[model samples]
Target: MSWAVLVISGVLEAVWAAALDRSEGFSRPLPSVVFGIALAGSMGGLAYAMRELPLGTSYAVWVGIGAVLAVAYAMITGAESVSVLKVLFLAMIVGGVVGLKALH
Candidate 1:
């Protein structure tokens, strides 16, 4: 359950990041609201997960998941360009996250 919540939190992290980008320095009302809500939810989930998981592992996994998703979304939406190198590094990040999951 904790792991599930942590993963959800990681996804929320990506959501908030994308929202933040869309917010344009908080000038846009809708995206700014989305950013605030997602950010809060993500942090809350992370805090809850930390109760049972190792701090370092949880944090790293959270960041790794968030980063990969953010970049992938950007590329998918054409907000960012895709390249082989970028995809390769994203795969590496996914591998590392999976490796961490396998550890425990």
Candidate 2:
């Protein structure tokens, strides 16, 4: 359950990150609202997961998931450029996250 919540929170982190970018410094109402909601949910879930997971492991996993998803989304939407090296790095991040899970 905790892990599930953590994963959801990590996804939310990506959502909030994208929404925040779309918000244009909070000038946009809808995206700003989305950012606020997702930010709250992500933080809440992270806090909850920390209750059961090791602090370092939980934080690293959460950040890893969020960073990978956010960059992937940006690349998909053309907001950021994609490259072979970038994909390789993202895969490495995923590998590290999985390694942490396996160790846990």
Q: Which residue pairs come into collision in candidate 2?
A: none
Per-model TM-score, in order, reads 0.98, 0.99
Residue pairs with backbone overlap in model 1: none
Question: Using alpha carbons, what is the TM-score of model 1?
Answer: 0.98
lDDT of 1 by residue, 4-96 (tens): 999999999999999999999999999999999999999999999999999999999999999999999999999999999999999999999
Q: Report the number of clashing residue pairs per model.
A: 0, 0
Model 2: ten consecutive residues of lowest lDDT: 1-10
75 Cα displacement, candidate 2 (Å): 0.3
